[model samples]
Target chain A: MSSADFGALKHPFVLRALEPSDYRKGYLKLLEQLTKVGEISEEEFTARVEETRHLGDLHHAVVIEDVERLAIVASATLLVELKFIRKCGKAGHIEDVVVDSTVRGQHLGQRIVDHLTELAKQLGCYKVILDCTEANVPFYEKCGFGLKERQMARYFS
Target chain B: MSSADFGALKHPFVLRALEPSDYRKGYLKLLEQLTKVGEISEEEFTARVEETRHLGDLHHAVVIEDVERLAIVASATLLVELKFIRKCGKAGHIEDVVVDSTVRGQHLGQRIVDHLTELAKQLGCYKVILDCTEANVPFYEKCGFGLKERQMARYFS
Candidate 1:
């Protein structure tokens, strides 16, 4: 019922579907951290937080909260896209899995992934894929994600 | 100078900044791909695309298009977040570098990344980070990404 209730569970952590209202809090947390460290101009940070809340709504975004802490410790989303490989197939691309640094070592990360993987399967994804930095390869591999042979790009100007 | 002009280059790939006007086209592309292949329901796909496009805008999305094809070959964004190390730094989290499958193996993918990397540098990002499956390790490495550490996570439901 409460954010702390969610985090205090004994088993690894439980996942929850994020509601529209959660965005403001999550964005503010991110903004607070950014501002405390002076990584963004206050103007830029405010604008980004507002914009990100809108985007989070669009992604069917979900969060893994530390129920005890009443904080969103980790989050991930399935970016479902259609593909015509040989024949049409549904693809689920997982993106944006962020875990709070304070809770990094408690196996909470693996729990969050397990939850997302199940969601992907239920969605009937022919393939559930995610990208991670080189450092994170072993973790995903441990989660059962194999290497995909594709080049990725982004156009930011 | 114009979206049409961007659509006119020989090989004519144009990398444009994401705007509110472009959200519809971007969302449509994501929905059509995911829905046609059955990754998500029409309703879910539409909703998710809208959220992602909005997020993309907040992060300063960019798109690469093949003018003649009138198709988005690739897209990516830079999420400006603060790092929490002793020497906290501003970092760029690169997200969703997707290139249409039909155009895979062309250097378009690399070009898109190059553009964004430059942008990250200009934006004063100490480092630009992205994630990919093990399969993409070599490709990203070839593009100059060094191995960091493995990231792991679990989903709780």
Candidate 2:
């Protein structure tokens, strides 16, 4: 479908505050996308999704959906995590920014990022950070993120 | 001096729990190392150190010393942060895992990681995470970490 066609695909693409009902569907979608990218194993993804859903009450998620049926197209979460660096004030970490591959080249990702950035600022974060692969550096840079000297580790054992 | 000679230099290295008196010096040491690595600008470093010292009260730091003086060989912090997913749980992020260059090749880094891992377990975290550059991947792997997925992002004006 053309960009305009997809844009008019009846998805309610508005940004809204995260809700509790969004957890199960959003977490499953995130797990599917992350597993597709080799980020987590099926088993770990299942466990992690369950764990994350439990944490749903603690954080916020924003979703884009189809207006009529309200099917989710993309989603991202803003986590209010404490920072040891007091100068950071309270920090917000953006996690699980995902858009369906069918619409990859479209501007959905950027829209979600913009929404989260504004949300972080409104939440009074001194800084907002999201970690991505080396390939995605330019994408985040365009979103006003400078390169941070941070790395990620996952524990399965 | 060579690594062996440096080890034999007999500087007073004290290993103790973080104390109110230790905040200023410890914060400066952290800022110095971060600045040396260019992770933060000098101005940003100064401001952040002051801020972290206040926040450090919520976390813990272990300092090393030689004889009668603190040497600041290594430190680890337990930062309370949120992780978003379907099964949300309390998370602890480990940061500022540092060991003096003079003490490289020693097991101090591993010791710090082990200590913090235990602390995370005690803090009731479902998981503990930290990010490092490619260069430090092997070190973290050796310390019992596996790879997670790479993050992707795009920015919009």
The two-chain DockQ for each candidate, comma-separated, is 0.12, 0.19
List runs of model 1 lying over 4 Å from the truth.
Answer: A1-157, B1-11, B19-58, B153-157
Which tens-of-lDDT digit does each residue in B14-108 have in candidate 2? 45554444444554465355433323345665554454454432255554544454446666665655444423444566766777677778777
B116 in model 1: Cα distance from truth in Å?
2.0
Position A31, candidate 2: lDDT: 43
Model 2 clash tally?
35
- For A1-157, candidate 1 gives per-residue lDDT tens digits of 1122234445445567664444433533642432343443446545443543443322344577655556666666554443322123445556556777777777666666666576665655566666566777777888877654333443222
Which of the CAPRI classes, incorrect, acceptable, medium or high, describes model 2? Answer: incorrect
What lDDT tens digits, residue by residue, belong to model 1 across residues B45-117?
4454354454432245567766675656677665554332213344566655667777678766666666667
Isolated chain B TM-score per model: 0.69, 0.64
Q: Would you give me the overall lDDT of model 1?
A: 0.54
TM-score of each: 0.47, 0.61
